[model samples]
Target: MDHVIKTLTPAARPPEAPGEVPAAPLRARPSRAEAEAAVRVLLGYIGDDPDREGLVDTPRRVVSAYDELFGGYHENPGEVLERTFSEIGTYDDIVLVRDIPFASHCEHHMMPFVGRAHVGYLPVERVVGLSKIARLIDIFAKRLQTQERLSSMIVTEIDTVLKPRGVAVMLEAEHTCMSMRGVQKAGSRTITTQFTGVFRDDPKEQFRFVSLVRNGIG
Candidate 1:
């Protein structure tokens, strides 16, 4: 049986005020044709003919994918954590969620970095639903990112929103830019870690979190 934790409520994401910018605009302000034109120039610079039958719609397709891939840019991560619930009535031990899948484009190469994130936090007063944790990952991962910054942002956001006693985030991934081209090392993986609050102050707690994640705990 799946152990469902229904006690954890879905956190409310408050709507932006009047005249406020939406966290993410579903529609792009600029016309799609302009985006398509930009992609056409990019393909041309790469020595590809944008007008060729095989490549004719490539520009438009790229623009469409770009809209989905970078949609996080228009969204605020903080808003995902705006509402909190404290009915659990306890705050002492670490809360761990592992194998949170994510995909990102490397800022350096614009190539894909696919990986899993392991997040742990010691709640001080409140908690958020598990889905929100994944949403947090999306907010940072959907942008061009360095793994280091991504890990740091996860911890920072959790710290800010939950006011946790401590937070820890670890990401391990293989970058397509590294594995598939240039100085290719096909199986190479990068791991990044960030810790704050109690996790930083207590080495034992930090080690426990790391060990558990490495051992494949959920």
Candidate 2:
């Protein structure tokens, strides 16, 4: 099937420094009733009776589900790493949180892509709690994203908040849009990685991070 692509020109903005959080683009939001009405339209588009017994409440349920699925937009990424501990005596090494499971919807199709994220950072003097890193992953995962941009955003947020010497992030996911539709290839995984500072500058550090991610200490 052929797809029609529309090109949109965005408004110009001032330059942003590295690690600077850009302002979110403003958009007029529809009311809950309007949103529900839109869902009913979609139901009708799919050749279903929106007023049918089983589907009578489907619009409300779908809107509620959307609130949970896309809650990231309402969260603050900066607050996730607001607190850090700097008292560790000479502990300067990679802090890795592996096998963090997450689910996100694709921006193109809004289909789910489930995955595991492996995140690591070399602390300069302070470090945030391990659970905070997991929360950081969740903050981004609950939004509509592409795997590549997701990995970059995670790395950028950690680097900006923690000011680590370096950051390494790897995401492995299977997009349902591909498996359930399109080519319909099942059991295929897509892996994306982003490295900054030392991890990006030095091959050895990148290798160590990858090795630790692949083979945890025995």
Q: Listing every candidate in turn, what is its Cα RMSD in Å to the true structure after a full C-alpha superposition?
A: 7.4, 8.8
User: Which residue pairs in model 1 clash with each other?
Assistant: none
Clashes of 2: 0
Write model 1 residue lDDT over 52-115, tens digit each, in one string. Answer: 9999989878988986897666566777777667776666678899999999999998999999
For every model shown, what is its TM-score relative to the native structure? 0.83, 0.89
Q: Which candidate has the highest lDDT of all?
A: 2
Q: Lowest-lDDT window of 10 residues in candidate 1?
A: 1-10
The list of candidate 1 runs beyond 4 A from truth reads 1-31, 216-218
Q: Could you tell me how far off, in angstroms, the CA of residue 189 lies in candidate 1 after the best superposition?
A: 0.7
| Error of model 1, residue 46, in angstroms | 2.7
lDDT of model 1 at position 63 = 83
Tens digit per residue, CA lDDT, model 2, 102-158: 999999999999999999999999989899889878878888889998898889888
